[model samples]
Target chain A: MTAPNGMRTMLGRVRGLGSAKSGFAHWWAQRMTALALVPLVLWFVISIISLVGADHAAVSAWAGQPVCGALLIALVIAVFHHAQLGLSVVIEDYVHEEAPKIVALVLVRGLAGLLGLIGVVSVLKLMVGS
Target chain B: MDARKRPLSPHLQIYRWQITNSLSILHRMTGVALSVGTLLLLYWLAAAATGPAAFATAQAVIGSWIGRLLLFGWSIALFYHLCNGLRHLAWDAGYGFSLPSVTKSGMAVLGATAVLTLAAWIAGLVI
Candidate 1:
């Protein structure tokens, strides 16, 4: 249903794009994670700076704090999710072959998610004081 | 896909170098770098959680000259990505689209990255 001005109807244009549909979800997720990361990343940088030259016990004790551990877990999730979304775009743009693109996308998502989980688990372990 | 050879759309090779273009590319580059740097962050966290011995090993490696060099690069990449991501957010909010404003903001992002990275390193050294 293209119009006289050579523009297809809104629904017509996005008819069969699969999961992404209109891409609003992906765009929003990226922006939301970026927004969350702004504060988390700042806290992380400050924490790391404060911990410089800190002994193992001191660093471990710091991480064992509930506030620190909670924030770190949040940082890990947000950062990895944001990175996964960003990398997916790069792969889609550069890897034109369908099979390779799918493989790369899966690998990126899987690894990012796995690392994110490990990061959270590490923080949780510290919080438990073990 | 088309089977016949046809003139392709203009790409990077056709455009003159500009701050905006450079910043756009640099943003992606830094993003990739930061993604890779996440492994180091994960290692530090895992080591800290594991035990004093593991933590000590992480500290020793990270304190080495080569490790510091890599950390320096990671620091710059982190700052650059953060600054440029904010710029993208501003664009999403429909600001800084004018040519002059775009160029100015690109320069601002670069300046902020340098200043923030420097400040971070100096603070790290002091503390």
Candidate 2:
């Protein structure tokens, strides 16, 4: 139904603020990423700190394990994804040149994806002994 | 390009530096640093996955003077971002809106970041 002289809905009152406009989707995404970071970051920092004195072989071996490898890959992805999202907002808000903003966005997406994929593949090879 | 009207000539150059302003600017600064740090993390992951030889190269870089410097900066960035992010989280929850609290938290976060960075470095050295 619709809200009108002859209809049976209240679209008139809701016209400005209802489904006509976007919801807090950006805010939600930010919060979701932030929440994911909470635990992932804690684990990552611990891992990094714990591995500080480790040698090349030890690090390789540790990261070679399936569980550790998978977690590192997850860390890489989450990091890049979060970074991309954060940079996009900054560029969108502050970059005065549209061309530069678009360039930055594309670069961030491509570079982050490439780096994250490389990290994941590296982990897989290490774990699988490839 | 679209042109917009401006009100006056007053700008950031005209203002005196203050704590709140510094925090605001440093928040963005740390965000950018963290973005770069993300690439380094990705590099570490990729190197780890490649194998012993590749991992060795990555290790050498990470152990190099330049790499150590970058890593040190990245560590500072990590801590700064974490502390500042916590402040943001608090604000999101409708807390710390008062000027005094904001400045206080800003200083606290800065201090926390410094302490954490130093602690991490000391731990790294011990390792």
* Best model number under lDDT: 1
Q: Under CAPRI classification, how is model 2 graded?
A: medium
Error of 1 at A28 (Å): 0.5
lDDT of 2 by residue, A7-103 (tens): 5356766665756254366666666677777777877787888987576678778887778777777777777777777877788789889899899
How do the predictions measure up, each by TM-score? 0.89, 0.84
lDDT of 1 at A97: 99
lDDT of 2 by residue, B4-123 (tens): 886785588887889988887887888889888766667766766565577678878888999999998988888888888878888999999999999899899989999989888887
lDDT at B102, model 2: 90
Number of the top-ranking candidate, with TM-score as the measure: 1
Cα lDDT for residue B109, model 2? 93
Clashing pairs in 1: none
Each prediction's Cα lDDT score? 0.92, 0.78
Report the C-alpha lDDT of model 1 over B1-127, residue by residue, as the tens digit: 8799898865878878878778888999999999998898899999998888999999988899998998999999999999999999999999999999998888899899999999999999975
